[model samples]
Target: MKGLTLDAALARLLIVVLMALTLLPFLSMFSAALAPSGSYPPGLAWPADPQWANFAKAFEVAKMDELLLSSLLIVVGTVPLSVLFATMAGYGLAKFDKGRGRWFYLVFVLGLTLPFEAVITPLYYEIKALGLLNTRFAIILPLIGLYMPFGVYWMRTHFVNTPKELSEAAQIDGASEWKQFWLVHVPLARPAIMSLAILQFLWTWNQFLLPVVLVQDPLQRTMAGALGAFQGQWGTDIPLLCAGALLILAPTIAIFLIFQRQFVAALLQGAVKG
Candidate 1:
């Protein structure tokens, strides 16, 4: 009992330490952002007179309003279609993992091995050929395609592990395959689907390379992608740059904090089931 108690206490201490390490950088950045514009901060100390207006100034100068709109549009275009297709594909693969279906699943699994950098050049050319370069579709389409492998894998794991009796019972009740998928499995897979949506949203929001390479106009690119331009123009202003960075990061952080419970629950559910 004493040994187990000691181990638990040690684990708690480690977790607290890790959490502090993770948050330290954010704390430092926040402190730096509150310092006067164009002034170099001294280490991680908070300013005597915090320049809270720096955030507002950064937002306006960065044209974050437009960037926010562009990001929302891309996310809207990307996440839903990606989730739907991945869910359907995953269900199909789970339901019919034989012969050609096995090959199809293998193809998707192979896609998982492909790194974004490896295919990005070819992807750029393809987008250009299709006249999608520098357009929202350029980022949106590629993101959906890129997200497919993992999204499908996540959903397939959920569907495969589901009790066969559920599908069988649905079939016995005169439910069509489509009905079974829509009415039965999808409802049960809500947590997995929600988790996948949250992940895809985060990825789509933070995507830098694709937006940078495929889209030329900074205004057309994601907020993070446009950060390159913002940094280049304001590289000398440390506090302002930090403020801009914090602004760019704020939305994702807000989203994660709000949905953290669902994210954690989904993960825990997967863990228990798996």
Candidate 2:
């Protein structure tokens, strides 16, 4: 590792800087969240005195519990609905190559290209027509739809890579097509599924724009929405606001810790697997 040429050493230095660039914000936020009360943090130089109570105070001050519950419900509800259909659609597209021109399927894939803003206007009217505005379902349902293209594409890619022999062998036995997918195909899909779950969970959890438009009712406001409001209400309450920011950051950090293996394996999987 130490035998690098000058150019290689410079490249390593650059890479380390870039890595620190990404990590600095999170590190600073964490330090601020734990900094001692009634004083300015040492501006991320290092923690002066760690105050664990900020987390509790943040929850109380921001009324983050309701917002947390709202955000959680959106993620929990949407991930499953979108993943289920996306799995079905992707699997179907991969295996059933007959019935329709692939152009139609490509349209499903192409949807990933369209910017969400281009579609939001139409979506607004559509939500109003359904009388779903100002509701959590309104926010969550649109998010599920918006995220579908990527999920389906990911699962489809995974299914396409799977050897057809597995399905063929399953069909040779008394196993039905559904059974083959569940017992055989799904097992192999773990990495792809995990990746999708991670991306979708984070995306949905931090989602702000859709919720802002579709859900004007504060009672239904999500964590992101509440965070926005909290920013307005307590702009100078650094400790309190940082506390809320950490509140938003906690679940994602926990999730990543829990699934770090999946993330690392997925990285290695991409490097090795097709």
Clash counts for the predictions, in order: 0, 0
Per-residue lDDT over 162-257 for candidate 1, one digit per residue giving the tens place of the 0 to 100 score: 899998899899999999999999999998999999988999999999999998899999999999999999999989999999999999999999
TM-score of each: 0.95, 0.86
Worst 10 residues of 1 by lDDT: 265-274
**Residue runs of model 2 more than 4 Å from their true location after superposition:** 1-12, 31-42, 45-53, 98-101, 266-274
Look at candidate 1 and tell me the lDDT of residue 114.
Answer: 94
- List, residue by residue over 1-274, the lDDT tens digit for candidate 2: 4888999999999999999999998888778778765566767756766788988987887787778788888888899888888898889888875668366578887898988889889999999999998888898888888888888777877898899889889998979988998999999898788878887887888777788777876547667766777778766767667878888778888988998888777566555643
What local distance difference test score does each model get? 0.93, 0.81
Instruction: State the RMSD for candidate 2.
Output: 2.9
| TM-score: model 2 vs. ground truth | 0.86
Q: Lowest summed lDDT over 10 consecutive residues: which window, candidate 2?
A: 265-274
Best by TM-score: 1
lDDT of 2: 0.81
CA RMSD for every model?
A: 1.9, 2.9
lDDT value for model 1: 0.93
